[model samples]
Target: MEGSKKGYQFTAGQERFRNLIPRYYANSHVAIGVFDISNKASFTSLEFWIQELKRYAPSDCKIILIGNKADLKEKRQVLPKDKLPWTSESKHPKIIEISAKTLKKPNSILDSIASEGLAVKKARTLKQEEEERENERIQMYGEHSETPPMRRRKFLMCGSDRGQRK
Candidate 1:
């Protein structure tokens, strides 16, 4: 999926792709859990998928929930109201409804996910860079001291000399 100027690749987390899930999770910035709105069983399975995501994906990873087959209003087994309770108790903040068959506003969904994922990736990168800088600073100066390690060592040595001269 393309978002603004950036592109994203999505992988399915089906049973057949179980072996690759861990590998994907390691590098994933966002995880999207999709279920069929027409199928109650599919909606119920989201819990299991969410648990798997939390287990394998990074702690900072963002999650998005999607309810597909919104076009099938008559056949829908999972109503919008029915999802509220589960969504409120779970980590998912919101659920997006879409119809894959109808191709209704699918690009908008992909764009939003992509943008969010990119934002997360950028934040993580910035955080990592900050930590690296901090580590460098800690290495140059003693962890709890304002002075550099070399300066502290010189001060200690000069103090010993002054004591001997006295």
Candidate 2:
């Protein structure tokens, strides 16, 4: 709660955020962590949220680092510290600067978010592969029935030879 300082109201804002984030994480496939580049307090708050998530996030989770409020370019102050693959400083997270006010490079944010979505897709694929192997193991031991669940078969097509959909 940061509102205690100079009517910032970040405390109220953060409460509203904490309430909404879990529902979003549950209903959506992706989560984004955003912050204001010109406002150090906002960035600090984002860092706190990231730390809280580390204990509960799944292995497949993806996180994006952003430096918003690029319109306040003269006031920029945050730094990247999380590991990101695209960043030359791989030890630090990727940070993109943009502003909703002047709309400076806002599309870059969308592109970064898309990259995170790609990571999630890969995670789901690996999970499906592991499940398939488990199914195969069960079949080898003769514990499996005539077929796996139709839903699990998904593209396998229990008896049909239609192959997988493109």
lDDT for each residue of candidate 2 in 1-166, tens digit (9 for 90 to 100): 1222111112333665765555444423344567887777777666565544453455455666666777775777764443333324532444666677888776667666666666676678798899998888687655655554655667565667566575
* lDDT, candidates in the order shown: 0.77, 0.58
Where in model 2 is the C-alpha error above 4 Å? 1-13, 16-23, 26-29, 79-92, 142-166
Give the clash count for each candidate: 0, 2
Maximum-lDDT candidate: 1
**Candidate 2 backbone clash number:** 2
lDDT of 1 by residue, 1-166 (tens): 4343544446565577777778878867777888899899888877776777778988778888899999999998998877533444655545789988898988888777887788888899999999998888888775876768787788779737554643
